[model samples]
Target: MPSKFGFIYHEDFLKYNFGKGHPLNSIRIQMHKELLELNSFFNNPNIKLISTKPCSDEDLLTVHTRDYIEFIRKLSETGVGSVDDKDTPAFKNMFEIAKTAVGGTITAVDEVMNGSILHAWNPGGGFHHAKQDSGGGFCIFNDIAIAIKRLIKKYNLQRILYLDIDAHHGNGVQEIFYDDSRVFKISLHESGETLYPHSGFEDETGIGDGEGYNINIPLPIGTFDEAYIHIIYQILPLIAEFYNPQFIVLAAGADAHFLDPLSHLQLTSTTYIRIAELVHGLSHKYCGGKCVLLGAGGYSLNATPRIWSLIVSKIAEVELKDEIPVEWRSKYNEYFNENNAPIRVVDDNPPKIDPERYKKISKYVDEITNRVKENIFMLYGFFKLIK
Candidate 1:
């Protein structure tokens, strides 16, 4: 199965783990690699496993402030405070851990940009909530933004599109490029009405020259797969036809799976794979086959690795012929309460799609999609008025 896809990985990434019992912990990364190896997936000769050097201070300065970088460096060495009001907590060595994660993403970006790979993936990246000088939501620096800056600077990329499918709104990423027209952001998440970070409203389009470049679809809790596929089909193609970016970054978060403990969204593993395929196809169609993928949130003990496995297999286009690996399951049995861990290739049954919730979300999706269409027309009329 030797192929052209590139994967970003390094052993140092696991050292950045939060202390034991944190929701975002080190076990997730270890298990993902273990499953790939146990199943003979990464053994394919076509896929290249790589370790990238840490991004330099100049790289960090592109999207992060100098004072913030210095503060983080000192704090990483010795700090015992919280980085956010909730979620991201400060601890010793926070700087090195966060920096390594940012560097992993940069390495992925550089691989794709330099013609070494067509697509690159870094499961340790996607720290979307950190602002230029501040940390929040368990994120210390904005990896996606740093990568975007690198692309723009080195390649002179004119337009970049960021699509976040995480359960939480990407308020930090959205605010980072709020006034930069070269970036177009679209986020589909559990509406702030019920989720954390509580931003991403319909009217919060881009400002100034970036006006209308940012798009947000805040969904209600409990929405399921079919509704997700239908609405995304509509909007994604429209985005492909409209913004036409040079490349797209997918903030593909698996926590939206129904089994995840973090949020109330009810999507299944299949949905994650389908979205990955769509993003890959759209990138090829519009962005010259260049795509950068990042893993975000997923917390269900049994579901996290399975959902990610499905996504990786689909995006990487590898076929699986059998059942779950015994060694991998045995290791996590105690941690997962034994009975609740994934024991088969896929879940025994599809997640409950909740008809009532699906209907409500369809209504919301239809209304919003139509309004976006209508607003495009209204803008045209305004241009005529000025003339």
Candidate 2:
């Protein structure tokens, strides 16, 4: 029997490379794939492997402007100019890579909608910072928005929940959906006050009919594993209670790991698995285990693969003991001398928590969960009063 657990991955996705020193380089994707193949969960009878073609111009236009699409096309053909903030230089084929990424996401959404899969993972998609007409944060297309457009048009799913945990805010996604009442965009990220592509503020919930539908839980620097769990513990139930979405998407970024060079969040491998478990529980409870996972930001090659391996293990219902693979580290050694990449799945064997950091994070946990409880009560009263 075909399974609802499917994966959308491609060798060609590696062509979307951002060059040396860039965090969004192709190696991250490659390393993640390598680690995934090392596990047998994907070979399970219930897991299906699939791939998708590039999105057509019409599909791309679902969330992007024609002019912006044209600009990318011309630049892609010419292989000239910079599509990202000077930091993300575009060589030839940048357009194809970005389009294919978006196509991969839509294909996953299409499969999920058609019941071809109960859950899907798109390693090349989730470029969440791109807007309708422009690129930002190394994201060339808002593939998330593209997927949402199709889900709404084809399936009429009125209540969609989007949860992002990238180190950076998903500004483009929030901007596109901020006005629509049918979709809710919630992000847990480094405070935009300190991060790049800054936007996800607490007060920026959806407006008009969509008011109070969106949520953002910005965190301070040095936020550790326990603290993030507290945030997710608080936000997930509260959001579930309030919006009641039948469809959900999570931007599972690995950059929040304590080892990542780009961000300050000190989340560990074990914590990531817990988050995946949370998502699994939420989907099972609210949407019959119907949710799609999008690969987002993660720069540390050494740390990123283990984080994803843990996630894939949960998604595919595989149980992995706390042991790292040897071949995996050998591969990492070939690619990285001492810098980004790592040979083993997770360094330090087991991730450790500084006693002081845990204490601080614990404080934040209490604050966020308590605040959310207050709002939930207030909303309960307001709705009951209106009734």
Candidate 3:
């Protein structure tokens, strides 16, 4: 019997590390693996562990230019240069690791389309900020875009939905597919006014035939779980129902959590689980449960691993205790020299947002949501009942 869930991972994934102090550390990936291992998730008969091979040059060219690819290759060989202005640096073998990440995502898509699994997750993928000519935000290759292109060409997929919940905008993915009507991109993130890459405004609906196919909901800073959930529940289902995509790709970033160092959203582990549940439910309803989840930008070491663990558990339909495994906690404590590692999977208490502040944020989110609905939803005939 085939497994219901497939997880793509390789030890080589740890080679994508940016250095000791960089926010995009690969240690978080290892920690997530440890958490799942503590729970014996790999031993489950319904879950399959998959390995990844580096994608070929042809695969890279699907979304990147040959000149840019050569630049990255030379930088990787030298092992000492910044790939972009600053955020992404060229470490030893950077090109190979980034290529492997792309391959992992493509492999996940193949598994889903071939009926090997109903769903898949790649913890080392989701380099969504990289563009055709350059890398940014610690991303060397836009794996999500390359995988989408491969899916369209290999399987002749007509309608594919790319949903991003990263705290920062998925500008690269949106840009790559901006003029393609067959792929719809929806991103919910902190307003660009306060985040990096500084794009994904509500007005960036699309271009030419792709107009209205691109949807962005820019939430205000300090937005809490309740408000976030409200916006998600209101917008996602309607879009999924209207688009009726053949497949769903989710960029699940943990940076929006209150404990994260990078962004100003107040989401908790519970919020992560809820978001995953919503995406999982939507995939089942509209795409026959053919969804691929990718890890994106989450900086806080303690919070990121736990948040991702919740997402994996949700997809695998496994229940883990609230308490973290004692042995794992001790090991991480020894490794990080932090005695305060969380012993429980879920946050003990929800991060509190002032009622008045939450109201203000909620109103702002409503305005953006309404603007998106009026601008894009109407074009798709989804506005009839929304208004």
Candidate 4:
């Protein structure tokens, strides 16, 4: 009998840190782990707390180029210079730390597939922005891609669904599997026009055998929970049903929250729960709950932990008190020095978007959703052309 859920963690995950004042802080991961512990979420018999180890160069070679792997190794030795140009700053032992992060996800996939656990979440994984030969968006290794490749190789599974909701598009993963039909990739992000790595346009659907397997939904600025959830609820289930994936990999980035400094989307905690619920349902419905989730991107020290906690609670079917634990709050204050630590597990209300602004956003979302239906959904025979 498999446990209901597994949460992967490692103290070395904190070493994946970039530097002071960097947006991709590792402390949030620690805060989330401590929060769950303080809340007694781990005491449940159905939940398992799993330790992680580092992946080898051979494992990384499954998705990255050999020359690029050597480059990261040499850069890690120097402990100076960035991985690409600016975003990914290299540090001593960075290659080793990144390999550990990738290993966390791989272990999660193995655990789920081998029936040790029904589902798993690797807080250190989800480096979707890392390309084959270079890094970007603070991502050093494309762990999501590597894990997917490992799934196909080890389990002989086809029809894997890679869903990314990081405020930024998953350009690196899309680029790697752009022409491959075995993977169906969907990214819902803040429009690339106003964000970094300016791509993920609606028309960037896949080509050749991969045509229509790639889906991108670029939301305009000021997108609130109503519009955000509406798009997800409308599109995700239909695609999952049609794809009937044998495994699911989710890049559940918390940066889409309204409190996050990195993106313009205004999602509250409710939307995160809704997403977890939908994904949990889809996994059981399509893949025997063989799913691995990765914490891809989220910058808000205050909101990110709570958002992740909520998602984890939902997945484990564990109920939590709304109040933040006093001991955890003390630790948070000491680490972050911010007075505005979240007081509750969930946000009280969704932010209000200006009516006119929301109207424009709704129109744009409809257009994008309709375009996806016509382009991607039609390819799966989920939509029909009307004359």
Model 3 lDDT per residue over 1-387, tens place? 333999999888888888877878788899998899889888988999999899999999999999999999999997898998677888888889899999999999999999989999999999999999889898999999999998899999999999899999999999999998889999989989998889999889899978889988887888888778877888888878888989999999999999888898899887789888998888888898999999998988788889999998987787776789888787778445348888789887667788889789988877776776666557766546666
What root-mean-square deviation over C-alphas does model 4 reach?
Answer: 2.3
lDDT (Cα, 0-100) at 299 in candidate 1: 76
The residue-level lDDT of candidate 1 at 134 comes to: 89
Q: TM-scores of all models?
A: 0.93, 0.93, 0.96, 0.96
Which is the winner by lDDT between candidate 2 and candidate 4?
4
User: What is candidate 4's CA lDDT for residue 32?
Assistant: 91
Error of 1 at 62 (Å): 0.7
How do the residues 1-387 of candidate 4 rate in per-residue lDDT, one tens digit apiece?
333899998888999988887888899999998888888989989899999899988899999999999999999998899898777888899999999999999899989888889989999999988998989798999989999999888889889999998999999999999998789999999999999879998888899888888999988888888788888898888888788899889999999999889898999998999999999889889998888999999998888899899988888888878999988887778545456667788997668778899889898888777777766557866434452
Tell me which of candidates 2 and 4 scores higher on TM-score.
4
lDDT of 1 by residue, 127-231 (tens): 888898888877888989999888888889988889899888888889989988788888888888898888998888889977777788888888788777876
Indicate the TM-score of model 4: 0.96
Clashes of 2: 3
Give the Cα lDDT of each candidate: 0.79, 0.79, 0.88, 0.88
Note the clash tally of each candidate.
Answer: 3, 3, 0, 0
Candidate 4 colliding pairs: none
**TM-score ranking, best first:** 4, 3, 1, 2
